[model samples]
Target: MIKLIATFCLLALFDFTNADIQADRLYELLKTKKSRNSPVSNTWSVSDEATNEYSPVYIASQDGLSELDKIVTLPGQPSGVDFNQYSGYVTVNPNAGRALFYYFVESPTDSSTKPLVLWLNGGPGCSSMIGAMAELGPFRINSDGKSLFKNDYAWSNVANMLFLESPAGVGFSYSNTTSDYDRSGDKNTADDAYIFILNWLERFPQYKTRDFYITGESYAGHYVPQLAYTILLNNKKTNQTVVNLKGIAIGNAWIDDETSQEGMYDYWWTHAVNSDATHAAILKYCDFANETSSEMCYKVTDKAWDEMGDIDIYNLYAPICLNTGLKNASGTGSINVFDPCWQYILETYLNDTVVQKALHVKPTSWDLCSGDTDARVPITASRYSINTLNLPIETAWRPWYLNKEVGGYLEAYKGLLLITVRGAGHTVPSYQPQRALTLFSSFLGGVLPPPS
Candidate 1:
């Protein structure tokens, strides 16, 4: 069951096959949307608001030149954008020639005063650019596939956002030592990411003491926590607060192997994706903690998958993009008007030579996840993982609101909080941007979401 679920979810989310399909679909969509005479405007501007009053303590810093990585502009970016953006490689292991890529976006209004957030997208091998471009980054690719539009709910609007492509093999990050790629795993990935952070701070010294938070989704469940642990261990050994590690927020993450698997099947069963007979077989024949299963367990799960049919498991109710290039035909009754083919648009835009050169990236093909929703690391998996911690509840689970509508439910544990985004799949922000932003704001503010 474990192996099956991981293979199904991870491959569906990160496999190159889906990326190719999405890219082709994007071209078809663009052909229909682009106009010859009145071209889409590339220039966009957001009015500035007053400087944010919630400021963190600042420490005096020595100047470090980061001009080499500063992005003058991105291809087709809106003119008059207020914030500074930088992207480049940070060498984590010089001896091995292992380097990781990063894209940093400063807060638009009060960058110096805002906290720093590091965002990772987890495949254990997936690139963080997915988070930057598709989820909560400052820009969204236009249908023309060569222009950009602003993401109004960009996390950078309130925090200085840092996106990383880690472990020296994902995205633009690379290692001259070929064996490093094969050896990359959780421990090494976490260590290299920590080194990347240290080296990155040297390049951008002003942020060394900034209040920092880590966030990610899916396999990042492992990346975020492991990296945070490394940071904490180093700080404890040095007896000094090195990174100013503040907090971490993981959305629909896959943290534990056992609970996540159990939760996933439970979720499928409870949500009516699997038959009761299959659920019974799983419970009777599968041993999640032991990491063993009978042949019957496999048979039952295969049956479950077949019964689930062609629906997007990530968002149970979202429309599925068909091979025929159809739109809105799945009829899943989703809450958000999610573009089933958005990944193709992103891949088309990012793979453009002009866009790569402007971002200072080497020419390489970009791939996307299979679907936009969150079933890969389902919410039920998160719930089960949290339950095992056995922490005392500080607040009862209750519905949280956005614009007077129920967004999701959240429960505050002694040292943690678990919040869900209603109608969100594996990727919360992509499915419900406004609600994700609301949850993010509440997290950074160290408060609960509005319960009223």
Candidate 2:
């Protein structure tokens, strides 16, 4: 019984009245989850055979023309920023009039030396701009809902960060063919994102040979691996390193359907969010591996939801915004802390005409994660998925620290690294920015977190 927030973009859309209906829709989607049938592997090795030739779609000369997409400055951005910012559309399918919108930020100090990390935020329908604006991006929206402040822990400090609003219907990306929207799924998303990256590299040719990594959270658990696989296959097919992909990482990911569902219920029970009887009933009646469940299973799951009450299940201990209607007021917490009402403030800022013009997006309504922290995708789900892999542990779990304070725990597997933020929720960066940044830096550096 996984309850979802309907759409992660609901907050961006500034619509809350039909949240329950959206949650129901998400639950149904989860119930009918389709198996991608893609193989799961602990290590993904790219082809060793190489060629000097580039993809037929890539043209080095197009690099100079990318200035057309350069962003001068955001509407309310702080001054003294040194990094270059760019945002615009890249046409992935000209015939279908399909284009994906992206925002690119170079590292402030070493634009040429740093690796390029492409980030996707999962909604399957949500925009990645949420990552850019609310999570690991370079700036944070101020409480005033009209200005921005620098995020000291922004990921751009160590890597050239690219955030994409993917698929045809999400965010500013679009396809003129209305039927294209109906065709959205895992395969289509991976294919379109692949094409988007190919075309994007042509625009920024300097990064063509840069070490590239894919990262995301939530449903991106699916998107990141799928896209990485696509990149590998295409590279092997062409015998060329079309995209110099290195690795991928997902946080609080929803990787496997059966394990994720089972783990969700288990997490709820262990966390004392549900009654003992409801947990027992679920364990007795639910068949998570099957496409359908017993009627008793549904009844118990619904009961579990009722027992949980109105808490932010994402970060169970975090406060819920008592005043979601304060669209213009400044939020209560600082940039490093989670502000329950920050989404409302961000909605007002992004919806501003000036901001839209600056970002080069049309005046369409923006959306945020309405169901981002839903019970459907939890940290426990990720843990279960990892267990299914059963990779050999290279390093046993140990506490990781930052500045003499315990930040999280880390464990290294034969081909995977598992790290946990002590108090983070579904969106790790939002709840623990500094710790999240340290994790990201360590991931890029291929080193363990400080054990002290």
Candidate 3:
């Protein structure tokens, strides 16, 4: 249904948030209307009745993650690299035979003192390995699609990075019962991730008390916040420090559909991507304030996309991968601009049997973008509304500086934080690695990026 709606608006060419935005935006408005007449829980919990009927679907168990911990040796890892890398599955639900695949990279130096950071990618079904191998991880896929190179600005340099392929049917993560995939949603995703983290900590007790943070992009605007909310709820329930959660930082976050979509159209107009007439039409016809827009809104949106052409919405200025056939092209340094073909090359590399074996990835085909291909875990917009609305206080928006220049803007609410990578698109780190690293290091240190 969400995908069907994207067809009406030119498929997010004008709005990077895509169909999930409308789904969430509409759901929130409806939920708010409903909440006016009834009560809703601040923290979501599985009822005994629901659990008793469905819980038995879990059919397996694991006591520790130690045995699952593994050392990875990529085909062309840079020589003399000092960090330890692990990739394997951590059973989140043994009875249901549910497990989440993970890739962990310790800091190259001082692994003990650095904070632990979990990174998720939002297709709601996308693999964080995309973040690991192509974005901020220690190693990047060579253009040849068969080797690796070091990422100097990798977030792992400042914190231990852990990436997961979650909700089953994503990347290599799987469940024995096919029904589990069909039942996946925001709440279950968060619930399972919370358990995954807890079980993961038990496996690596050394970092049981380490400061933790969650970060991701795109739909992760939903994932990161929901997971953080879940952790906070558990913390209150136990009245004790659970996972030592510090804060979360999301890049180009899609927190609220209405605001972000409005901003996107406004962005197109201001950036000259939309014609003056079209921009005015959008402004006049679109009612993002109420979630769903009018038919005229859809018409103008289509016109906006027609003018934008086949550009990468993720980075309006970034080049598109025109030479995908040349997967073996020589790699280049991480520059202000990204390698347009990186995604193509990454897919080729990750789908290789040799690469999959090395990473302990289940023998399944891999793609750079999931694009909600898995029906089991539909993008649940209500999760965003639920988490964001249930928060005890509103987030305070402010500027964060680095080296005397505005690094980016930020919003903080209790234990959660939202960040924008200045001039970056959907994937912040890819287009602005330095700015991303600055944002990341600051968040981990519990300080704003230093003033320019």
Best candidate according to lDDT: 2
> What are the per-residue Cα lDDT tens digits for candidate 2 across 1-452?
11110111001011111222223434555744532343222222334313344454332234555798888889878889899999988887777888888999999998899999999987657778878887899988876778888888999999999999877788788888887887777777887888889878888889989989899877787788888877876786764337888878787776767887887788778877888889999999988887667778778888987888877766666677787665454543367665677667777887898888888877777766422453546656666777888888888978889999988777777768877777676667877788889888888887788999
Best model number under TM-score: 2
User: Of models 1 and 2, which has the larger TM-score?
Assistant: 2
Candidate 2 lDDT (Cα, whole model)? Answer: 0.73
**Model 2, residue pairs in steric clash:** 5-371, 8-368, 8-369, 8-370, 9-368, 12-367, 12-368, 13-367, 143-330
Minimal lDDT window, size 10, model 3:
1-10
For each candidate, what TM-score against the reference?
0.82, 0.87, 0.78
- Candidate 3, residue 416: Cα displacement in angstroms equals 7.1
What TM-score does candidate 3 reach?
0.78
Q: For candidate 1, what is the TM-score?
A: 0.82
Show model 3 residue runs off by greater than 4 Å. Answer: 1-68, 238-241, 289-294, 330-337, 371-420
Q: Model 1, which residues run further than 4 Å from truth?
A: 1-65, 239-241, 323-336, 369-373
RMSD of each: 13.0, 6.8, 8.2
29: Cα error in model 3, Å: 16
In candidate 1, which residue pairs get closer than 3 Å at backbone N, Cα or C atoms, i.e. clash?
314-375, 373-426, 374-425, 374-426
TM-score of 2: 0.87
Q: Write the per-residue lDDT of candidate 1 for residues 245-362, one digit (tens) a residue.
A: 8888877676776787687778778878789988898898776675344567667766866777676666677776554332323222222355666666667777888878877877
